[model samples]
Target: MADGDKTIEISMDRARLDLDYCYDFIAASYWSAGRTRGEFDRSVEMSFPVGAYCEGRQVGFARVVSDQIAIAYVADVFVDPDYRRMGIAAKMIDALHSHPELKRVKRWLLATADMQPLYRLHGYADLDDMMMMRLDEDARNRDPLR
Candidate 1:
């Protein structure tokens, strides 16, 4: 159940496990991933996914890949802009923090460009020794076609 005037109910249950609605929401939110529904569908088909709904419509989501003993990486978290500031993002994070399978993991990691304070509420922190790196995609694309 959700709090206050918010009409949505937050849940941690697996999404269709296919990125369909997930990426639709992602593309809608970020204008990135000129995605086809098929791509999202295939991606989540094999992963553990969670989603939120408002009036039975998906509004928020988060997912984790975990091993019951050691670690979990939380990824692809989002809530629609119209739903922002309504505590939806925090609720989604809380659901992940409280997940049963995730509890056994010794540690959890997540990557985000912003929203630090929101995540911090669930005890998330940045590790000093870990500097992040990413392959430059444009450079990768410049390689001669195979």
Candidate 2:
């Protein structure tokens, strides 16, 4: 096999997740900063996770919150700082797209501030004329754990 082909592997196995690495990365991210461990654990538990591994160590991660039908929301995608520029993120997205359960999803959604270019390459388009709305619930303010 070519060195490029052997460089990384992507898997949908939740057992292979490195929670500490994942949580730490998400906690430091712009979107999920200040996220608690319990929150991370719960989120991961509720989603179908994908991990990209290099030499048996997880180097990237992503998850899909799907109803296994019409919609699937891609969330918490990240490639370790050390692993950026390695095409790992694109591969991870490809794996998610090719996932058996997600294959039939009519719509896939994700929110990204700076990775629009990357996502655009995968057929995600800007919601230029459409209104994207959300209910802003402050979970930290409502959760007793805070």
How does each model score on TM-score? 0.70, 0.82
Model 2: residues >4 Å from true position, as ranges?
1-6, 128-146
TM-score of 2: 0.82
Which tens-of-lDDT digit does each residue in 1-146 have in candidate 1? 55465587776555333346667676675434676776666545544567777876787787776664456677678887777878888777767666655555556777776766776666776554332222222332332323
lDDT (Cα) of model 1: 0.63
Off by over 4 Å in 1: 1-5, 15-19, 28-39, 128-146
lDDT of 2 by residue, 1-146 (tens): 11455488889999999999899889989989788999999999998899999888998999989885667788999998877888888988888877876656667778887887788788787664321212213322332321
lDDT at 62, model 1: 77
| Candidate-wise lDDT, in order | 0.63, 0.79
Total clashing pairs in model 1: 1
Q: Candidate 2: minimum summed lDDT over ten consecutive residues — where?
A: 131-140
lDDT of 2: 0.79
Candidate 1 lowest-lDDT run of ten: 131-140
